[model samples]
Target: MTRPIAYPSGSWPPRMPADLAAAYCGEASVDVFLRQVKAGSYPQPVVKQGRRQIWAKADLDRAIQPTPDHDIAADVALDL
Candidate 1:
């Protein structure tokens, strides 16, 4: 298993774990998150410090929220 990324509070550079990508994107796969980022379907994470990729928890929360055009009924059907 891959190790989780850790970020210190008030740290200049922030890093997020692959699991966070799964939680944010509703898909437990880092590859999927990377694909979404490449496709512009998801918000890009900020790169702070030297090479750390940081995603704000608030930003991730907003990104995961259902949009106005989301088809709730369709999602429910798909879940079944």
Candidate 2:
């Protein structure tokens, strides 16, 4: 059996799957998250602890931000 660590360090960031799921479109679906991970759509994992992926919360949050130009272009295409 193995004991759990609280990840009391800045380097650790947030590695919980729930946090990752939330950062990924506010959905808690691990299946979709894993697919995105494989598709290289999510932020790169900062660290690999055993079999766990340590995702930087800031970086993960950044992935969801849409560029202004992309949104404007979409609006233009839609004539909105």
Candidate 3:
């Protein structure tokens, strides 16, 4: 099992691209993250510098939070 990445306090380069983000989050592959972003369900990028899409470490931390039970139930109901 891969350990999650830890950001240093007041570190330089607080943003990360998809591949590093995937590894940081312990995701199996970068494609998993890319698909979610393409699907429009993932957190929006903070900025796009050249060809690199960037997200804040804080934003990615927030994105991994589990949705509330009520919200999950509502989504499940809608799918039915």
**Backbone clash numbers for all candidates listed:** 0, 0, 0
lDDT string for model 2 (19-70, tens) is 4444344433555565677787776677766777667677776876777655
Per-residue lDDT of model 3, residues 7-79, tens digit only: 4355435688776676655555677667677776567778887877888878877876666653656655765
Alpha-carbon lDDT, every model: 0.60, 0.56, 0.67
Clash pairs of candidate 2? none
Which has the greatest lDDT?
Answer: 3
**Model 1 ranges off by over 4 Å:** 1-15, 48-51
Which pairs of residues collide in model 3? none
Judge candidate 2 against the unseen true structure and give its global Cα lDDT, from 0 to 1: 0.56
> Model 2 — which ten-residue stretch has the worst lDDT?
1-10
In the predicted model 1, the residue pairs found to clash are: none
Off by over 4 Å in 2: 1-15, 18-24, 69-80
